[model samples]
Target chain A: MYRQKYLFLLPGLLVLVAIILFPLLFTIRVSFSSWDVYNPGLNWIGGENYGRLWEDARYWQALGRLTLLSVTTVLIQYVLGFALALMVWRDLAARRLFRVLFLIPMMTTPVVMSVLWRTIFHESLGPLNPILESLGIGAAPWLSSAGWAFAAVVMVEVWQWTPFMFLLLLAGLLSLPNEPYLAAKIDGAGPVRTFFSVTFPMLGAISVGAILIRLIEASKIMETVYVLTSGGPGTSTETSSYYIYIRGMRDFQIGYSAALSLTYLIIMIVALTVIAKLLVRALVKDAA
Target chain B: MLKITDLELLVGSVAHLAAINASFQPGTLTTILGRTGAGKTTLMRAIAGLIAPDRGQILLDGTGWTRLPPWKRPVAMVTQQFINYPHLNVRDNVAFPLVRAGVAKADAAARAEAALARVGLAAMVDRRPSALSGGQQQRVAIARALVKKAPVLLLDEPFVNLDYNLREAFRKDLVDLLAVETGTVVLYASTDPREALQMGDQIVLLADGRIVQSGSPRDVFANPASLTAASVVNDPPINPIPFHQNGVADFGALGQQAITLPSGAYTLGLRASDIRAGGPHQARVTLTEVTGSETLTHLSLNGLDLVMQEKSVVLRSPGDVVGVHLDLHKGLVFGADGQRAGV
Candidate 1:
């Protein structure tokens, strides 16, 4: 029986080994070698690249920003998403229309949205600054100031990703049995009490799952930030992906770039493993 | 303590309903009887505050509840789907309302245990809903509703999905348990005639969203107000034989007899159990099903398929040429316009 089951899964196993396993192994091997674009030859550098990465201030700053972005984005998305889901759920009159409207931003291409936001925050002739100016308020440079630029990137990232969280959490909310809510209501529970006691506890699994998925996506987000800020304003908004791109493609330092990529990959693996363990715990508790 | 008056509801512009005014005396079990889509569920939902009527008034102890939201109505409902929280253990699911009411953890636990013990699920407190049998899950739902202590309980076909024996036991237990709560009013809905007759003290018969009749179960079942109510409130049905009034009901095969007519063309309604076999009336047996205890015999009698439920030792074979008899005094007669005739 086990053999038969394995036979059925042979195609998937082959695909995984070919696409994922092989590439990962190849990348790890390349990370340890000094094979720059100039010299199309590999010189075993051992732990030299690893040692350099530890002292790289730019890499550490980029890593820190990415961490901050991932944490802040996940937190914001979870709250905003859950709130939106609750609102949509309670307001049955416009639920379908609101769901479709919320999903529009998520469906739009990230690159395209980034371009649109770029125009809107263009320091002058942009919609936001002019609106502020019109309101008798001083207009601040949105993407030009380093501090403002980082904030803008975080805000835009949250906006594009909030809908993803909402859709996921909404599915969880909608799929929940309506009985608990009714029971709570019958017990004379006010709306707020019912939500905390019934809705939030029941949705823990879905909330964790949504956050983990958004966290993974946040760590890999590239196209939007690349197009919007280009990791400029003294690399204040620079993420790991942009830093890797700057080393490999712009500076032609493939060896250093490959080392950085490997480091990021390890960080991701550790983060995902921790998150997966927590998710499993949450799911098990829910199941129990 | 609950009264529903002048309730009218429309379902998404597709169906319209106008349920009759009904009241439940404290601690009384009022059974709502109807066919599918007869607005039984809609009426229950309206009372539970799950559905808003385009026009109506609901009163709990004479207080207007129509304007109150579901949370304020003090009503608990167990739907046909058996509403229990799947993620929570049986204990937590039962204690859900208590916990929400700000009962301390230990107190809530004690209450949950008591409710579970009442439902005979105390040993399975930690079990999830999926692990429980259909009947067990239903008990958990009941336990949860019981723990809520709502004065008005609206149950929509709570026993619809349970096996016959379990259904009977749970129905009995539920009626008995709810009976002890003097201030609570239970409105139970069912499409089953047997259940309605056995469990209902006061029965409301509905057809096409209108209350055809409302009275004691005995009265509604034995002397229904209309042909629809007669058919709906009896298992094996109070069989109706069409006949032109001619100032008498013509039971074609049983021979013509002068029967009193209230008004309009009338039909004779005979209870299947009241019918007897081996008479002069000639008819062919269309179907015969022996269900261990009794044999249900059907015949093509005067263009209507007449059913006779009898405790016969020997089951009659289908396609048998048989003679049937009717106890006319035991059956009702309905007028052509569907109203009860002669009473």
Candidate 2:
């Protein structure tokens, strides 16, 4: 019976091996050698690519920017999305309206949203700039200045994705059993205490899910940055994905790019594992 | 320490469907007995401040509670579902109110443990509700109420799901628990008359959003105000034989014999337990069913179905015509207006 079950899963297993497993192994193998695009044969240079990656200041800067963007965006989006979901969850009259309105941003293409944001942030007579100027504040270059460009990308990313977290957290909120809230009320707990103690702890799984999804999206934040800033004024808005795009695809250093991609994959795996462990630990302790 | 006066609750649709008028004194256990859709649960919810009564006043120790939300009402309600938080352990679920009340964590835990111990769930304190039995979960819900130590304890079928023994034990424990708490007023709702008989100090019988009868349990049982109240308070129900204005209560089939009453278009109510086979009247035995300790004898007499209890007597069988007697002194009489005949 167990053998038959394995046989039943054989086709899916084969597809997974063909599409994912084989390619991952091939990429790891290729990343170690100096296999050029033209030659297409492995010429082993061993640890040279790894050593070069360690010494690259541009790579370090990209990693730093990626970390900052992912961390800040994840935190901000989690807070804002959770708050909006809680508000919507509490109010029956506005729940459907706000759900539709908030989810509208998530349904739109991220690239399209980024382009719209870019137009809105245009330096000279954009809607926001004129409004700012009319309001007696000097219009600052939103996407032209290095710091402002990074900030602009972060804002666009948050706006496009906060609704994703909102949907998940709202589902989590709705799925929670109503007893704790009633128990809290009977205990003389005001709304604030009920939210922090009863509501937040119960929403732990959804929060973890939201953060994981946001982290992955934030790490691969290429399309929005590519459209809005195009790695901007300097490499200020350049994420690891953008860096990989420039080095591997644009420069066509296939083997070197594959090596860099593998390194990024390892980092992603490590971070996600650590985060999952920490989250499970905290949740278990809280449950205890 | 709770009093509800002229409590009228109208739930938006109609003027009369949700109206409840009653005044309950403090520290008394009142059981609101009703069938499904009779608005007993609605009345309790209104008093607990879960639903606002359209026209009434809820007072706690002479303080106005008309506008208070459930959180501000100083009342705790255990719903029929035994809705304890599944994510929380028994201790935390019990201690939930104290934690919310800004008590120190240690103090709250202590009180919660004591409450759990009171409900006989101390050994299962750290277990989640899913891990517990049905009776244990109900105990946890009661522990939540006890730990809250709220002045008014409202229970909507809290013991509905327990087995017979557990229900009996829990009912006794609940009575004792309520007795020890001086300021606590327990308002329990049950469809079962047996539960109301055992636990209620004051019994309010409801039907179609109106209180048909509200009095002490013994008074309600001994002299039910209406045929409906009588039926609701007994197992096989008080057999109501319809009669007419000639001072004759007609029980129509077995012989269509006229049972002369005191006066008017009155009905005679004979409880199944009060019906005996020894006296002068005769009834054809229609069926006899033995339910362990008691035998339920169904009979056809005076054109009505009369159910009576006999203690395993081997005197009758199906279709055996036998002479039976109803103890009229213990019978309740209801007049044409549906009120108790004497009242």
Candidate 3:
């Protein structure tokens, strides 16, 4: 029976090995070798690509930008999402309709959303500039200036993904045990006090989980930047993934890009592990 | 006094509470007795100011409290589920209300400790609610309410979630705790008649969102005004048999002995304890359940099912013929409208 059960899992195991394990091992192998699309030959470089990545100023800048984008976007998204979720969770007329309307942005394709936002942020002929101009503020070169371009990319990322956080946090809010809230009310705690004392504490684990997921996804952000700015105006918004794409596909430095990708993977693993530990500690502390 | 006059509450389209009128005296523990969905919780919520009544006035000491918010009301409620702030320890949980009331931290902590000691949970002050058992969590909730020191305490079936042994102990503890709570009217809602009889100084019987009866517990149990009141106040439920009158002061049942009631169609209600075994009337024992100290014998007499509780350790088997006697003087007679006829 055990042997038959093992046989039943054979096809799934083969697929996993083919799709996940093989590519991972190949990437690790190629990181140490000098291989380019034009050369068509693999040279045993033995850590040369890794050393080159460590010395590259543009690679470090891209890494820094990736960190800035992930942290800023996740933070802004969490605040805005929590506020929206709280508003929609209230007992109001057409609340369900508002919830559904808020989730539409998240349902749209990321690339398509990026294109739409790019048009909206157009410096010369966009609705955003006209609105700002009408408000007596001058039109901003949203997609042209380096600072504005980065801010634009972050805004698009936040706009597209904040709804996902809203949905998760809304579910967390709705499923919270009702008794504690009632207790708070009877105890004469006002709305603000109840939120800080009871609601926020109960939402700890879910908030941490949402932030972790958004952080992981944000760290790999390339599509929005690629569509909106394309790391233009002197590589201001070049995230690590876009930087790797530039090296591998645009510059044909496949081995160097592979090395950079491995380093990115390691950093993500360490960061996620640290965050998971902190969340577990928080949960355990709450339990205690 | 907490008085509700012409209280009408509508939950969506259905009338949850209709024309409810009752006045609860201060320093009395009034148990709202009813079955599930009998509007006991709704009444409690209305009194707590958690929900508004459609067309009624709730007065606390002659001041209208119907429009007041829950936080402004001088009331605290303990729900069926044990609700404690999971992240806060027992002391903090108990002190939360006081802290929110703008009491100083030291004063709140002192009062919280005193309340915990009152609930016999002072030793577990540092433990979180998750670390405590269900009974202990409820105690923490009670302590929280005690710390609030509200003039009115609404407990909505707070002991329903505990085990039988814990429930018994908690019931005693709750009774003792409320004993010394001067000037605070406690409204305890429960479906169990035994709990009402044990804990209530006054029992308010509700059925179909209407107040069927209200009086002292013993008086309400002994003379339930209607069939609904009798059914709500009886543990094993009152055995109601269809009674047909042949003539004046002559009724069917009791082996042809006529009851002294007017000639009419009626239903006779008898409590389990009032139906004795071994008398003149004969009945066949269908089932016998011995509960250590007493035996509950289910008997079929004249094609009517009757439950009799006896103290003797008699092992009456199924199909055994037993003489059943009913104390007719203690029996209840209900007319067509399910109300007691001729008092």
Sequence-dependent TM-score of model 3:
0.85
In the range A89-180, model 2's lDDT, one tens digit per residue, is 87569679988999888899888888899999999847988998889997988998999999898898889899999999999998988877
User: On residues B104-188, what C-alpha lDDT tens digit does candidate 2 reach at each position?
Assistant: 9899999999999988887988899889988888889888887787778888988887877888888898888888777778889
Top candidate when judged by lDDT against the true structure? 3
lDDT (tens digit, per residue) of candidate 1 on A1-288:
666877988999999999999988877777788777777566778978888888999998998898988899888988998888888976678788998898788888999999999998898878998898889997988888888888888888888989999999899988988867766666667788877777887887887788889989999878877988998787989999889889888887777788899999899999888977877676445643
For candidate 2, report its TM-score: 0.90
Our model 3 lands, by Cα RMSD against the true structure, at 3.9
* lDDT of candidate 3 over B1-343, digit per residue (tens): 9888999998788989998999988899999999999999999999887888899998988999898888788898898989988768899999999998999999999999999999999899998899999999999999998788888899999999998889999999999999988889899999999999999999999988899999999999989999889989997789887777665433345644456667778887888899887698889999998875788899998888988887777788999998878876677889988998757
- Candidate 1 yields a Cα-based lDDT of 0.82
Candidate 3, residues A210-268, lDDT tens digits: the string is 98999999999988989999997789999899999999999888888889999989988
Cand. 2 Cα-lDDT: 0.81
After TM-score superposition, the amount by which residue A225's alpha carbon in candidate 3 deviates from its true location, in angstroms, is 1.3
What ordering of candidates by TM-score runs from best to worst?
A: 2, 1, 3
Candidate with better DockQ, 2 vs 3: 3
